[model samples]
Target: MISLKNITKKYGDKTVFHNFNLDIEENEITVILGESGSGKTTLLNMIARLTDFSGEISGAGQVSMVFQRDRLVPHLTVRENILLINENADVKRMLESVGLSKAENLYPKELSAGMARRVAIIRAFSHPAPLLLMDEPLVNLDLSLKFSLLEKIKELQSTTGKTVIMVSHDVKEAAYFSGRIIVLKSGGEVILDKKRVSEKTLTETLLNGQSI
Candidate 1:
């Protein structure tokens, strides 16, 4: 499990989280949901140890992250990028799983947006990390691609048993992927924290601006 105690993050004069706390269980998916600029990404960065904050976090193992952007190497082929992280990674298998078998030899510049995102996810999973952090990875994808990628993610998580912490504004995505849902208000206050409920209930909570 991962624990965050008294997490306080600030940017100059503006504060994001003050004495915020959370606990994430191992081998489970936790979704942090909030609107843009609500400090959702900041919270993930803190857990990933990618950002500095005044807090104590424990039980986090090695982490692999997928950002909002694909962030693939423009000069490297899709397989090459995955190999860069894990030399013995099953690049072909991963590509095939995401229906990108033919994209193994293609560079990022030659791949579609959804394809690039798949490569990014595959690269992150290829690493030997026990924890995976995702920052709104499905943001701009079409609905079909979004559901497809979500299935891929579910498969990867179940196969690897990696602990996942994802931040997103999409309630349906949250309902579908998360075992636990944490809704944050602006300035990083957790307005709702509960076990997975129906998508309709989650949507109603968001629309009603209610906290639980």
Candidate 2:
């Protein structure tokens, strides 16, 4: 489990998190919900040790992240992209799980936005880590593709059960995918944190969606 206690960060005088605390259990998908500039990404970065912060985050293991940007080399094929991250024996299986089997030889230039995003997802998952962090994993995709990617992500999580944390603006997506949801305000304060209801409960909320 990842335990964050009294976590706080500041850039000069501006504060990010103030006395924030959370206990992310093992093998659970924690989704963060908030508007733009709510420091959700900052929080994820902190957890990944990619950003400087003044706090105590207690966890000892490898961590990998699927960045907000696809971050793929435009000239590299899908297989090459995942290989670039880690040249382990698990690379082929990872790509297959994310549904990029047929596009194995296609370069980033040839894939659509959703397809590119899936490549990034497999890249992160390819890393040998106990914790996985993803930011807006399904950023620019049509609705049909988005849900398909979501299911693939779910399958990947189930296979390894690596502690997963993803940040997204869509509450419906969070509610549908995550086992627990943590809502954050623009001020970096956590507004709500609750376990997501089952699919039947989520269907009721998603179908009657209002403005986020």
Candidate 3:
């Protein structure tokens, strides 16, 4: 389990999270949903220790992240990117699992936007980490592709049971997880938290900006 206590973050004089507290269970998918400046990405950053904050977050050991942007090495091929994290990784099998086998030898420059995103995802999952953090993992993809990638994520998580925390603006994406869904308002406030919810209710809560 991951425990966050008294999380207080600030940028200049504007506060983001003031005395915020939350606990995330192990081996589960928890998606953080919120609007802009609602501290969605900031919360992930805090957990990954990419930013500074006054708080105690325990049980997040050796975290791997898929950033909002696909931060791949331009010079490396798809297989090389995954192998960079773990030399013993089954690069071939992983690529095949994600329908990226044909692009294994291709460099980031040669890959389409979707292929590069898949490579970035494979690289993160290949890393030997207990916690996986994804920021906007499914952006700019078609509906079908988005759900397919979500299934891939589910498959990986089931096999490895890594604690996955994702930040997303898509309610349909949240509905697909069938796990913990958290809706945050401004100041890192949690307006709704549920394990299972229909898209209609989730949309309404997000639109109303309050718990129903």
Q: Which candidate is the best by lDDT?
A: 3
Task: Kindly give the stretch of ten consecutive residues in candidate 1 with the minimal lDDT sum.
Answer: 203-212
Kindly list the per-residue Cα lDDT of model 2 for residues 1-212, writing each as its tens digit.
79988888887888878888988888878888777877889999999888887879988367988888989987887888788778774656666776677898898889978878888888887788889999988877788888888888888888878889999888668877758987777667766667864544444443443222
Error of 1 at 64 (Å): 0.2
Question: How many clashes does each candidate structure show, in the order listed?
Answer: 0, 0, 0
Q: Between 1 and 3, whose TM-score is larger?
A: 3
Looking at candidate 2, what is the lDDT of residue 84? 78
Candidate 1 lDDT over 29-70, as tens digits, reads 888888887899998888888899998999986789999888
What tens-digit string does per-residue lDDT give for candidate 3 at 14-81?
A: 99999999999999899999888999999999999999999899999789999999998888888888
TM-score of each: 0.96, 0.87, 0.97
Worst 10 residues of 3 by lDDT: 76-85
Comparing 2 with 3 on lDDT, the higher-scoring candidate is 3
| Superposed Cα deviation of residue 42, candidate 3 (Å) | 0.8
- Relative to the unseen true structure, what is the C-alpha lDDT of residue 17 in candidate 1, on a scale of 0 to 100? 94
